[model samples]
Target: MGRNTRKRRTPLAAKVVAGAAALAVGGGGLVWANFHASAHEEGPAHHRTRSAAAQVATIDCPDVGQQLSGVPDRARGEVDGELATMDSQITEAYQRLATTRRAQAGDPRFVQNTILGPLKDRRKAIIDRIQLEIDRAGGRADDNLDQLAGCQGRPAEQPQNGDGQNGDGQDGGGQDDGQNQDGGQNQDDNGNGAAGPVADDFIDINDVEPNSRDSENGLAANGDGGSTGTFTTDCGVNENNLFNSDNLIAAPGVDNGAHHVHDYVGNQDNDAFSSDEDLANADTSCRNQGDRSTYYWPVLRLQDGTEEFDANELGGGAEGNVGRILKPAQAELKFVGNQQGDVVAMPKFLRIITGDAKSFTNGDANANSSWSCTGFEDRQVTDKYPLCPEGSQVVRTSNFQSCWDGQNIDSANHRDHMAFVQEDGGCPNGFQAIPQLQVRLVYDIPTPTVENGQVRNPYAVDSFPEQLHKPITDHNDFINVMDEDLMNEVVDCINSGEDCQ
Candidate 1:
């Protein structure tokens, strides 16, 4: 299937220019072009106009191959030079901002302090742009030159098969003279048939019976001595033809937990609670609570069975089974990914504590199960421990902590409790356990802030002052403060002056 099917295009002059630029920048050290010209004669040879021929003669064109060859090295050099210039400028600007900041620390007139803000942001943007340009030009030039080299022919591949010669000094395909006597069967020199149809080794299907001993029916009859017509085989059945409801039967011993009917099939154990009894009890318990959170605790059994808690009882109400206690040593926490974060439905928070000692106050202790107390006062301690906090009715595990908020529980203090109990082992089993909690946080695009309003040079003495309220710096700020137009103008000037050295 090998074929030369690719279409080719005529190489353009612009490509040549680009190739040359690539080669110079990638291979040569030169960053800029140098053109030499003599000064024109005063008064243009006594005001005499030159002819078109003279003008053409005066114009000089460089060798295409030479120019293309130097492009890679030249491009690389230019990129490096530009980066260096940008870096120096950024550094200088940063220093100026820093100096201004130190001198005008509290001056109301210099309200927008330049030490660590907008100016620094601008410097960062310029540096970033310069770096991007350098990488693009240098990489393009190198790639072009490599491609050009491949386009030129390299070497040819060799054939692998060996020459043919029999040990008897005769051609490998040659026949013996004695074998050609009759040639009725077209025999070879070795007396073997060269051509003609031969009899098949096995009997034909037409000779065998349609329901004979070799068929599936035959095999079944022979195995059990039963009539083949009595049974029907599934020879023609396919996956698509199988009906979901056709062969279905009520599972055996479903009432005594011998078998289970899955949720999709309209079984009682369709939800977190194993049976309708548990769900009814839980629903009744929460009915009179009037806007309080409720949970269904799934208690797995030893024989792959499950039990559920009465929600109303768990919440200590009179409508149903209340004050239903769970033994901590026997109950393990369950984490449902999608259901964890719903406040009205699950009403639980999930958090994960890191094993790093630096993440907790009891750094010296084993932190594998410890919780975090960071931002406990503000109820925002979930940053370090992403799971539910303690004292908020959390379900404890070997590696994670979960909690439930009942009666306006302080989420932060709960987090603190989880962290403390995990490290110190103060929380005990049978201490009024709450349903295990799980929570997840989702984020959108980042918010804009003053620091990001402009690029900042960290080392500058007179950079823009960072905004007090915001943490992140953004793209718009960098553009507004940096002189992008001026930078572009410089680039254009250099590009237009092709004759400049």
Candidate 2:
């Protein structure tokens, strides 16, 4: 009966303990499930979705390179043909330059033409090459567009799991599909990446020369085919150096053997006697026919005969003799004869009167009237004749005699035939007493000799040898018109005053 009671207690205890253990296990499983579900909902899966959505936000229809693949290859072929033609033409130009040099040997003009002319042709060739490349690239541009359009037509795929199942389990995750599509697109983009089609229209190839030289590590040559020694290298470097310097020196010299001695005929000098004879002949031909006698005027002197009129005395006169002897009283007389035996009067005046003789006329109406003594009647005349004081007036001889006393004798009345005289104590109203006048004959009268029944003047007689008087036919006109005093007044006004008042 005691054992039955204990067994009942043990069964009850086992049931109670088993119930507690089941409850604990169930609660812990619930907690674990909740935590794992929350973690899955909040992590990388959410981030991946967001990232994928952002990537597809705005769809670019055609990528840069894909647009170029749609063009046909035939157009590219035409561009390639054009490039070939350009290359041929440039090659031919260079060959022609070489041929020209061979034909002309060392001619400088030919050498210059060969070098510079080919350079221009090569420049054109380079431009043509660049243009052809651009054309070929452009031909391929349409192909890119077709490829881009084809790519856009397909739908984007989603990411997949490693088991190759789609997220929806029916269409696979589409991620593997998308990656496959993207890989092909990337390859097409790379294949179509021909930059020449997209290059600027004015892309000049000359700029590439420096780039090419850099690629070769700067080992280069100058234009004239000489090594630059600086490491840079380019296509035209050696050619440029050769043409510019080295080739020029290698060119041959020109032949100049056609020169003749007759070219220097006039450069030779004749003997001295021959030159003198030619000069003498020229002088004889230019000689005048008249005045072979060489008449010289008498040399003037002071009354005391102390000083003779030398060339130095050409313009000197007594202080009171203002107009008595003309200013510039004497000049060397060289009579150039005309066709006849007489010297021309007007021409003689031109040769002797170095100063302005027209100023001596002073616009007097009488000066224009006549050459005789009658014209002198209206003009101012000097008393004591030509001898007058500075700024003095001359009166008629009748007036002079009227004012004269017999003792004083009115010495101012002195006159010669045509002009007034300054002699014998004749002094003008404003002047001091007159100085004396005298003459010293220069040319001796030729001794009469009977030659061929004719009397002739000796041509070789030595006379005074100092005569220097110049002829003055219009003496009254010169004296009455301008005087030294008036000239001084005009000169003074010009020097110290304004323009003529």
Candidate 3:
């Protein structure tokens, strides 16, 4: 189809829009064009201006990958590769956006002309390739794929503490200027400043309302005919240093697909290039060798100046995800039965991704980030990084979907084949209940101090540079490579209501 022949989008009609204020880049600072007073409450749309300078926190682009649910099977690989390329383009553009403060100050249109414009162009070309791949494979590509090419700058929310400072403490900077001594954007020692985890991102657990779901933090209460048993897998806490940025399930054959390092446990050979056969024969990290499933999630980091091996590499410090990689104090992997009824054995090689890696800009629709202080697991928060009281550890939890479509091992989005249980605790119509994978990761680190608008010793999960390490972007990945016999055993254990390891 010709460029002019393609359908055009109606303003922001089909875009993954968020927030009440749209950022307009100008005068080296971001201008807020407020369309509404707040995002949560209903209000009349009106025009307003804020004189206070707002940070151009991150770039927001419509998530093309999420919308591609019909790519032909034969075209999936190429489409995935192009999608990975788009991610790299965004990372590069974000880097330039973060470092070009002076240029932006001089040219009101610098950010648009220099950063987002080129990014859109690059993404446009890639989107065309994706469309071609799908078309050639006999699938009708979305006519509006080109509409998703345009990108915009998103402003970061201001700090919530009212006071932004260091107090009477040493380094007595008193109040934050939101800039470093050199007039550049203030950043962590590893240079993650422009990307994020600002002081407002952390909230003391005490302040969070206790609103967690009843089923969270543990297996659900048994229901009539439900499998009440539990099965636990002993996967070490990634002590063997199994780490990578590849996501074979989402972007196979593409290196650095995740754009952030992951702490891997379970299958020993999981990577972008690993085929099903390679995984089946790979070494195992689980105590039970019959289970060679791969489980991985973004590594957590302490922004305390210590440099990890990947500190200067693409997925690490160079991409604004710097700091010392913190090892988990405890890694608990459990498979619990569904509350509706017995769960069937999960298909071998099934791929599942829980949570949204881009939730920072993508919004929390798919976000499964469950963070809390160890003793206060009952009050889990999704968006804010939990501030643990002294002596308390931080906890990260991922509750995987327990329902399946029964046929496909995976889907175009890697999500359609799986589904979460319904409110009544039953699988949706046409879906079969399966063992729910529950992961709880605990970290032992120094409590971050927030005072005078300054955060000290802050810790954040690794993320796509554009994601800014937001707590809501936290996610987990899993691929079931368990042998059929072992899988059957798990099903049997759960149905029998016996706890087994």
Model with the higher lDDT, candidate 1 or 2: 1
The C-alpha lDDT values of all candidates are 0.19, 0.18, 0.71
Off by over 4 Å in 1: 1-433, 444-501
Clashes of 3: 5
Instruction: List the candidate numbers ranked by lDDT, top first.
Output: 3, 1, 2
User: All candidates' TM-scores?
Assistant: 0.14, 0.12, 0.83
After superposing candidate 2 on the true structure, give the runs of residues whose Cα lies further than 4 Å from its correct spot: 1-74, 102-104, 108-119, 122-501
What does candidate 3 score on TM?
A: 0.83
Number of clashes recorded per candidate: 68, 37, 5
Q: Choose the strongest candidate by lDDT.
A: 3
